[model samples]
Target chain A: DAGVTQSPTHLIKTRGQQVTLRCSPKSGHDTVSWYQQALGQGPQFIFQYYEEEERQRGNFPDRFSGHQFPNYSSELNVNALLLGDSALYLCASSPVGGADEKLFFGSGTQLSVL
Target chain B: AQSVTQPDIHITVSEGASLELRCNYSYGATPYLFWYVQSPGQGLQLLLKYFSGDTLVQGIKGFEAEFKRSQSSFNLRKPSVHWSDAAEYFCAVAPDISGGYNKLIFGAGTRLAVHP
Candidate 1:
C-alpha cells in the first residue's frame, strides 16, 4: 500500500568520498534490489538482497555494495565515488522468489558525485 | 547475458493521436518482458508485462504491449494519447538464471512528447 520509499531525495558527494542510500520496500514485500540510471540512459542492475544477503549481482564493480535488514529495508553504499557515479540510484522491491515477480520502484536518490 | 534496445530516442505527436514505441530484447529463452513509464525526477512505473499467456498485455493508463517472440520484440501502444502521456518509456527484460528471476536489464528508453 505504501509502495517503495527511498531516503535523501538527492545527495552530493566529492570524489574519493563514500555515500549510503536507503530504501524501504513496499509493505508485504521482502526482496530489495538496487539500480543505477545515468543521464539519458536506462537503469542498470546493481545488486539484489534477499534474506539479509546479497543473492544476485550485476556487472558492477566491488565498490558497489548493499545490505538488507530483517525488516526488508535496504541500503546501498558506494565507496570511492567517481564523477561517473553521478546518476539516479533507484530502489526496487518485489515479493517471493517466484519466476514471475513484479518490481515496485521508488522515486530514487539523485547522486551527484562532484 | 541479456539486453534491451529502444530504437527511438524521442517521439513527438499531437494530442488525440495514436502512439507506438518499439522495443527489442536479446535473451537465451522466452524472455519476461516489461514496459515501465517514468516522469521527470520520478521512478519507473510498470505499465505492463509479458510472462506466458497472451501476446497482448493490457496495462493501467490504457497502455498495451504486444510480445512477438519471432521478432524478439515487445512494442508498446496507446490509442488517443493524452498530454499527460508525455513521458519516458522503458522496456526491460528479466533474465531467468539458475531457476530464479534476475534483475531486469533496461533499454536506453524512449521519451514521448505530446503537443496539445
Candidate 2:
C-alpha cells in the first residue's frame, strides 16, 4: 500500500506571498494533520482536518489554514509568509477510530521563505 | 498543556555499542507516549508507543522504550547500535482531548551519530 505522499518536495516563497502545500494520506486513512518542523527542532502541530472540517488546531495564526477533500487529500495554505515560516511542513494521517495514537507521516515539503 | 522534552541535543556512539536516549513528558493524566525516528530528508517513523498495560515496549529495528509513570519519562534503548541507526529521534505525547483525534506534542529531538 502506498504511504502518505506530499507534493512539491520543496518550495520557495517571498515575504508577504502565499504558498500551498499538498498531502495525500495513506490509503484507508481519512484524517489529515499538518505540522511544522523548524531547523534543529521537532515538528509542532498546526491543525487537523476530519470529515472535510477542521477538528483541532494548534498555536498557529489565521494566516495558516487547511482543507481536506472528499478523497482524503489535504492542502495547507500559508498567507503573508514571514521569514520564520521557512521550515519543513509535514503531513500526517491516521484512521478516525483505528489506532489514532499512531500517525503516518509524509516526507514533507521544505518551505523556504526569502 | 502537554509537552515533551528530549534533553540531549546530540549524541555520538561507536558502531556495535549500546545506546540510550532520554525523554520526559508533562501531562495531567495518563499520557500516550511515542518514539519516532527521522532520517535526513525523510518523514517521521514510529519506533514505538506506550498507551498502557506495559511500561516497556519493543519496537521495530531493535528499538525499545520504557515508560516510567513516576518519573514521567520514556527512554529509548538499543542493545547494539548500527551505523545506519544514526538519525534524529523525537519523543512525543498525545493528550486525550474532546475529539477522537489526538494531536501530538513533540520534543526538540535528539540527533544520533554513529562512528564505525
Candidate 3:
C-alpha cells in the first residue's frame, strides 16, 4: 500500500510569487491537512480539507489556502509568498472517521523563498 | 487550546547509552498524545501515541512513551541509542473530542545527536 505522496520535493520561489504544493493521501484515507515547518522549528498547522471543503484552519494568514479533491489528494496554495513563508510544507492524511489521531505524513516539500 | 512542550532543545548521547526525551502538555482533559522523529529533509514519522487504556505505549524502533496524567507528561525513551537515532524528535497532541477533527500541535522539537 502506498503512503502519502507529495510533489516537487524541493522548490525555489521569490517573494511576491505564488506556489502550489500537492499531496496524494495515503491509501484508504480521505482527509488531508497541511503544515509548515520553518527552519529550526516544529511543523505548524496550516489547514485541513475534507469533502473538498476546508473544515478547519490555523492562525496563518489568508494568503495560505488549500483544497482536497474527491480523490483525497490535496493542494496547498500560498499567495504573495514572503521570505518567511519559505519552509518545509508537510502533508498528513487520515481517515475521516472518528480516528483522526492516526495520521500518516508525507515527505514534505522543502520550499525556499529566495 | 491544546499545546505540546519539549523542554530540551538539544541532547547528545553515546551510541550505547540510554536515551530519554521529555515532553509535557497542557489540556483540560487527557488528550491524544504522540511522539514523532524526523530525519534531515524528511517528514515527521509517528513513533508512538497514547489514546487511552494504556499509559505506556510501545512503538517502532524500540521507542516507548509513558503517559502520566497527573504530570501531563508523555516522555519518550529507548534503552540504547544508535547512530541512526540522531535526528529531531517532536511531541504533539490533539484534543480527544469525538465530534470533529483536531489538529496536532507540535512542540519546538529536540534535536538528538548521537556520538560514537
Top candidate (DockQ): 2
| Candidates 1 onward: DockQ, in order | 0.75, 0.77, 0.62
Model 3 lDDT per residue over B38-58, tens place: 998777888988888989999
Candidate 1 segments exceeding 4 Å error: A97-100, B97-102
Expressed as tens digits, the lDDT of each residue in A6-38 for candidate 3 is 999999999999999999998888888899999
Query: What docking tier does model 1 reach?
Result: medium
RMSD of every prediction: 1.4, 1.1, 1.6
Query: If the candidates were sorted by their DockQ against the true structure, best first, what order would they fall in?
Result: 2, 1, 3
Give the per-residue lDDT of model 1 (tens digit) for A48-111.
8998999889989999998899999999999999999999999998886553368889999999
Comparing 1 and 3 by lDDT, which wins? Answer: 1
Worst 10 residues of 3 chain B by lDDT: B94-103
- Model 3: residue B99 alpha-carbon error in angstroms: 5.9
The residue-by-residue lDDT of candidate 2 on A24-114, one tens digit each, is: 9999899999999999999999999989999899999999999999999999999999999999999999985766568999999999999
Residue A81 in model 1: lDDT: 96
Quote each prediction's TM-score: 0.96, 0.97, 0.95
Model 3 sits at an interface RMSD, in angstroms, of 1.8
